[model samples]
Target: MGRIIAVANQKGGVGKSTTAINLSACLAEKGKKVLAIDMDPQGNTTSGFGVDKNGIENTLYELLLGEAETKDTIVKDVVENLDLIPSNINLSGAEIELVGIDDKEFILKGITDKLRRKYDYIILDCPPSLNMLTINALTAATSVLVPIQCEYYALEGLSQLIHTIDLVKERLNKRLKMEGVVFTMYDARTNLSLQVVENVKENLNQNIYKTIIPRNVRLAEAPSYGQPINIYDPRSAGAESYRLLAEEVLNREDN
Candidate 1:
């Protein structure tokens, strides 16, 4: 079975979606079959892959509610060797709607389990908040990839996030583990950025990726153009970093 990674962080504006979009694209570029699922209500990952929200007839919301089949929801070849199950604003209400559903947290897992053999990697872009949707993603995922912004309070709420992951692992998905933490928005020019990195390494016991994503205007502009960094500006530093991250992820898995 392929690895199912949930690119997750409860904190906002930490390059979580950017990592999800680009990592999937970069892995696809390496000739690995990848399927990215947009579980975020904001749908930035959906738009990042150039999928129009209004035009998508079948989405994660319908799939979770058992109203649509996975085959019908998947947009194949959204990027070369990459497929996407897009999400939109409507997903915002799915949490309340799922309140009474049986095994609500496992809904996503039920769907993704059937899809494992078809791809080398299945990346899930989770919501910013630790809502039912995020829980669902955690339940479905084999591992979690957190993107921490290289700024003050980089460790804030990090303990809680790890505690939650521990709870989920203990009670829900035993297969779930923290894949690693990747530093984002790193500025080699700033002492604070380097300090934050040192602090996290000292305090956190999780594995850390070597590829740190720098702050780049092109990375920020890619979503506006509806493309991943690798496709939006392949020569950009953001693209190069993500490609290196993909390589490291593959190597980590093999080891």
Candidate 2:
């Protein structure tokens, strides 16, 4: 079975989408069969892989509402071994539509469970908020990879996120675990970045990744070009960090 990793964070602008897009791409580059699911209604991950959201017919919206099958839903050959289950603005209304349904939280799991054998890693790019969509991702995932922005409000709501994971583990998906926390947008010149890392280490008793993604111009520009940092600018600091992160993920004995 493939490892299902939900790259999640309640706070926006924490490089959640960036991590999802690049990590999946890097893993694919390393020859792992990857399936990146765009759980966010904004569809950043969908476009980050160069898939046109407006031109696509079926998306995660159709899949979640049971309007489409997983075979018809998946966009094949997104980039080498990486496939995609794209999402668009249409997915935003899925929150209210999911109500009163039987096992709504497990709907996404039902879809992903079928595709596990075909891939090595299934990466879920969850929304910035803790909505129904995010809950669905959590229920589907084997582990959650959190991306924290190295800024002043880095620790905000972190405890709540961990608490939610615990709740889901206790009730929803007992297999769910914390993949780890990864620090993003680190600036070597700033004393604040170092402070944030040390603070999180002192407070949060979780597996933290050693590879820190620095705030690079290329990383910010790659999304606009509809490419991962590795493909967009292979020599960039952002690309190198993500590649290192992927190695750590692959080296892990748990998954």
Candidate 3:
């Protein structure tokens, strides 16, 4: 079965979607069959792969609502070996709509379970909140990968997210694990960024990825151009960091 990783953080602007996009792209470049699911209503990950979020049909919304089949909803070869299940503004209503449904949290799990045999990795890009959609992602995923920006208030927000994960592990998915934490938006020039990394390492104290994503202009610019960092500027620091991150992920599985 494929590993389903939910790239999540309840805090916004913490490189969650960026990590989901670039990491999935990098892994695909490594000849892994990857599928990226954009569960966020903003659909940034969808657009990052050059899929027009607004104009797309048979999106995640339809799949979640049982209106469409997974095969029909998927956009294949989004970038070489990567496939995508795009999301759009329509997903914004999923939270309210799922409230009265039976086994609501397992909806995503059921959908992904059927898809496990088709890929090596399934990456879910969750929204920046611990709502029904995020709950579904967490419930569906075998592990959660958190992207923490090296900045103030990082740990403050993390505790709440950890608590939610604990609750999910206890009552929802016993197999769910915190895969690891990746530090993003690092600025070596700033003392604050360095301090934040040290502090987080002291607190979390487990599975912190060694690859620190620097604040590179090329990384931010790639999204606007609808390409992954490797395609946009393979020689840039941002691309190298994600490449290292992908290798680190593969090494972890190997060990």
Candidate 4:
């Protein structure tokens, strides 16, 4: 069975998709068979991996709606060992369509259950809202990884997110757990960034990652080119930071 992780955060612009894309790439580089699931309707993860969303016949939307199987929708990415179950604007309608279905939250879990044995890790890039899609991802995941940006109002929506997770654990998936919180877009020179980090650490009680992703222009520019930071600029600070984050996650799993 694979370790299914949902990369989620209710707050937008917090590097969730970026973390999902690069971390999945880095894990593949480390010889792990990885499947990146784009649960966000924005399809940033789909485009980030250089997948032509407009041309794809089947995607996560089809899989979730039981119109297609995982094997049919899964596409091999440019990277050697990484596969992607891409998403697009079509998924935006899934939320409304799923409303009438029984056990709608388990739709994603049902899809992955048949395919979990093929990959070492299944990374889900969740939408920045606690919608049905995100709930499906949460129900499908073994744990959730939160990417929190180092900003003044970083913790504003965290309480609600945490509450939702607790509710999911109580009612949806009893096995769901929090992987950890990652601090993203950190700036060492900014006191605000430092304060935000400290605040998150204090609130989460040290359930935060040691690797802080610094604010780098290259990280922001990679998406425009449809590439991960590691491929866009291997020598850049953002690339190195994500690589380190990959190692941190792997090491933590080992112990």
Per-residue error (Å), model 4, residue 199 = 1.1
TM-score, predicted candidate 4 vs. hidden true structure: 0.97
Q: Candidate 3's error at 144, in angstroms?
A: 0.8
| List of clashing residue pairs for candidate 2 | none
Any runs in candidate 2 off by more than 4 Å, and if so which? none
Candidates' TM-scores? Answer: 0.98, 0.98, 0.98, 0.97
Tens digits of lDDT, candidate 3, 48-84: 9999998887999999999999999999998999999
Where model 1 places Cα greater than 4 Å from the true spot, the runs are none
Q: How far is candidate 1 from the true structure (C-alpha RMSD, Å)?
A: 0.7
Q: What local lDDT score does residue 50 receive in model 2, on the 0 to 100 scale?
A: 89
Worst 10 residues of 3 by lDDT: 153-162
Relative to the true structure, how large is the alpha-carbon lDDT of every model?
0.94, 0.95, 0.94, 0.90
Candidate 4 residue 253 Cα shift, in angstroms, is 1.6
The digit string of per-residue lDDT tens for model 1 on 1-97 reads 9999999899999999999999999999999999999999899999988999878999999999988999999999998999999999989989999
Clashes of 2: 0
Look at candidate 2 and tell me the lDDT of residue 25.
94
Query: Compared to the true structure, candidate 2 yields what TM-score?
Result: 0.98
Misplaced by over 4 Å in model 3 are none
Q: After superposition, how far is residue 31 of candidate 4 from its true place, in Å?
A: 0.8
Candidate 4 lDDT trough over 10 residues, lowest sum: 200-209
